[model samples]
Target: MRVLVVEDHEELAETVAAGLRREGMAVDLALDGPTALERAEINGYDVVVLDRDLPGVHGDQVCRTLAAGGSRARVLMLTASGTVADRVAGL
Candidate 1:
């Protein structure tokens, strides 16, 4: 499967992408939300591993844009926030 990993944490993003790659999935990394949107437009990714608190554009906004744009990729949201609202919003 092709996956896009969007995270502001460079080290964490690369680590996750490397692990996914080793598992045989094609993975791409986007260090922030705007870059994530750009890549998403250019690629037909099967999945998007998105960080909720991203730079440029918020991850929630990115997710909304993808859904609104009729993307078929599944979004898996990541966040360090402990709020119930944050979790619900991502879902």
Candidate 2:
């Protein structure tokens, strides 16, 4: 499977990418929302591991753009916030 890891935390992103690579999945990294959108547009990703509080365009916008663009890749949003509202809003 091809996966894009969209995270602002460089170390964590690299680590996750490396682990996914080790598991035999093709992986790419994007540190911000804009870069993530660019890569997603250019690449055939099966999954997008997105960080909700991303810089540049914000994760919600990224997901919206992808959906609007008719992307087939599945998006999995990650966030530090654990509040009920945050979770509901993310959904």
TM-score of candidate 2 on Cα atoms, chains taken together: 0.98
Name the 10 consecutive residues with the lowest summed lDDT in model 1.
82-91
**lDDT, model 1, position 28:** 95
lDDT tens digits by residue: candidate 1, 13-90: 999999999999999999999999999999999999999899899999999999999999999998999899877777
Per-residue lDDT for 3-83 in model 2, tens only? Answer: 999999999999999999999999999999999999999998999999999999989999999999999999999999899
| TM-scores for the candidates | 0.97, 0.98
| Overall lDDT per candidate, in order of appearance | 0.96, 0.96
Candidate 2 lDDT = 0.96
| Positional deviation of residue 86's Cα in model 2 after best superposition, in angstroms | 0.6
